[model samples]
Target: MYRSEFYVFDQDKPVPVIIRNYTQDDFDELIQIQSECFPPPFSSELWWNKEQLSNHVMRFPEGAICIEVDGILAGSLTGLCVDFDPNHMEHTWEEITDHGYIKNHNPSGDTLYIVDISVRPRFRKFGLGKLIMQAMYHVVIQKKLVRLLGGGRMPGYHKVADTLTPQQYLNKVIKGDLKDPVITFLLRCGRVQIGIVENYLEDEESCNYAALMEWKNPFNRT
Candidate 1:
């Protein structure tokens, strides 16, 4: 479904942001934006092959929501519906996203699993990331889903990797003792820290660890 979410600005020009379903034409720009958003080791360009993206588009057509600002690709958030165990150990991106088409995609499942969210380097601080989350939240509610799930890489984790454990570092962010721009932003936006997922990505920033996080839909109950 197409949704005209909001607008941003560039040099006094209003850039309309239209949140809508993923389309075939969005592939190339998406790959480009992804490449620019991340650096080596964790850069999606290294892992997300074109074939994988083709699979994603085919499997969850509506799951891959994209943001276009001023008629240009700016950001995106892709996800899947899954029936998972609360006690199940956190999984890697490769595990949750089995080559872009998750195996445990239960259409009737209660969880909305966010696979990835990215914003181009140029659009970094425009609050587009939060808008992506809002789009996912909208999807979860529209689908009657109860819980939202995802893993967050702590770019700030590398600075304290030698000093604090992943969870310990997460706690500092949670307690507001230390600020992790990404994790803390999500926290402030209502996402709760679930736990730590080891080997979540190849990035050394988190010591290969990611924080398992969730944002429950207040209007929907499990």
Candidate 2:
């Protein structure tokens, strides 16, 4: 189900990266970049699992896209085109889930759920993230997908509440420590915070909040 394709580089000029689908061959590099980008990113084993991988495969060739600078993978954006109803379905069964609860609770149709999008630290603050978002917006429009949604929870730094415990879960809620830059960047891209999932991310903490956001279909032709 999970697949990836590589655009090989023959010369030294900046590599032209077109947003496209992913292939298994991209795993080793994906994992490395992910680890460096997020505090607790997905492990190699997690990326290789059949169920997890299958969800990423696009029926169309350009299901996902990666940015390569000088033939080196720098960032990627993974998304899904589906009519999701978070209300009728459940999240427990899937190895990895996407916006199911949000859709069921809110009931949106033909949504383009952004599963994962990250750029390596070395490439941060260079406007690549916004570029990726713009590319994604165009792709969704080209394919006629309706809605777009993605967010990262930013728990304020040095302000950890005693109610929360265990660094894992706490990490998700406490975004100020290592995640401030990414959260700030998301805000600048025009995403608006919608809700906070209490204790949604931490593994040990008794409670925390997840900051949810939504970016209106920028590609919508009014």
Candidate 3:
């Protein structure tokens, strides 16, 4: 087990727990977590379908992972180590756009994409998500990838709140709920946002925020 201060539980409270990667054998458990997290999450049957798995995110054999407490699925993430290829990413965006599925995007100097990071509702604020992200960051760095990327949304990407104004929009809206906690946490960890894609999700009206963050390893840059 990778023991660290991050994994240490608060003595005063019951810590939401369990973290590990997924195997082919974990298909069922993995599917269960997805269903709980997404609005219209992918079904286990859908995930297990051979055709879907081929095109699915986190294509690595061990890239798909889960966090569970006891026996129930808490959260899961699908990630991959890939070269920075604009053409390939654009191609993927084009194909998925045809089906109304927006691509989650972020770009770094051209190394790794921290594809997905999610924590279960009950598990939030407990530190598992950070643990997973920290782990992924190290793994990507070890591979000598230039940077890390991922996709996220602006506040109104789904539904705009009528109460908030433009100023409120930028501050409370954008900086508050509009901001992705994962991205915010990432930024706090020294990653710099390098790019943005406007109107990236909806029909040029509602905007989707695409951010790129880079963590340069001094040794690798040498």
* lDDT tens digits by residue: candidate 2, 134-160: 666766666666556653545443245
| Worst-scoring 10-residue span by lDDT in model 3 | 98-107
TM-score for each candidate, following the candidate numbering? 0.89, 0.62, 0.63
Which pairs clash inside model 1?
none
Give candidate 3's whole-model lDDT.
0.49
Residue-level lDDT of model 3, residues 1-222, one tens digit each, is 222222335557555555666555566555555455543443343223333333233344344556666556666655554556544443232232222111322223345555455665666756666566665666566556665555443334334535644234434433555654445666566565545444344322234444445566545764
Most TM-score-accurate candidate:
1
Predicted structure 2, TM vs. truth: 0.62
| Whole-model lDDT per candidate | 0.79, 0.52, 0.49
Residue-by-residue lDDT tens digits, candidate 1, 44-126: 54634567667667777668888877777888888888876779856787887774656556688888888878788788657
Candidates sorted on lDDT, descending: 1, 2, 3
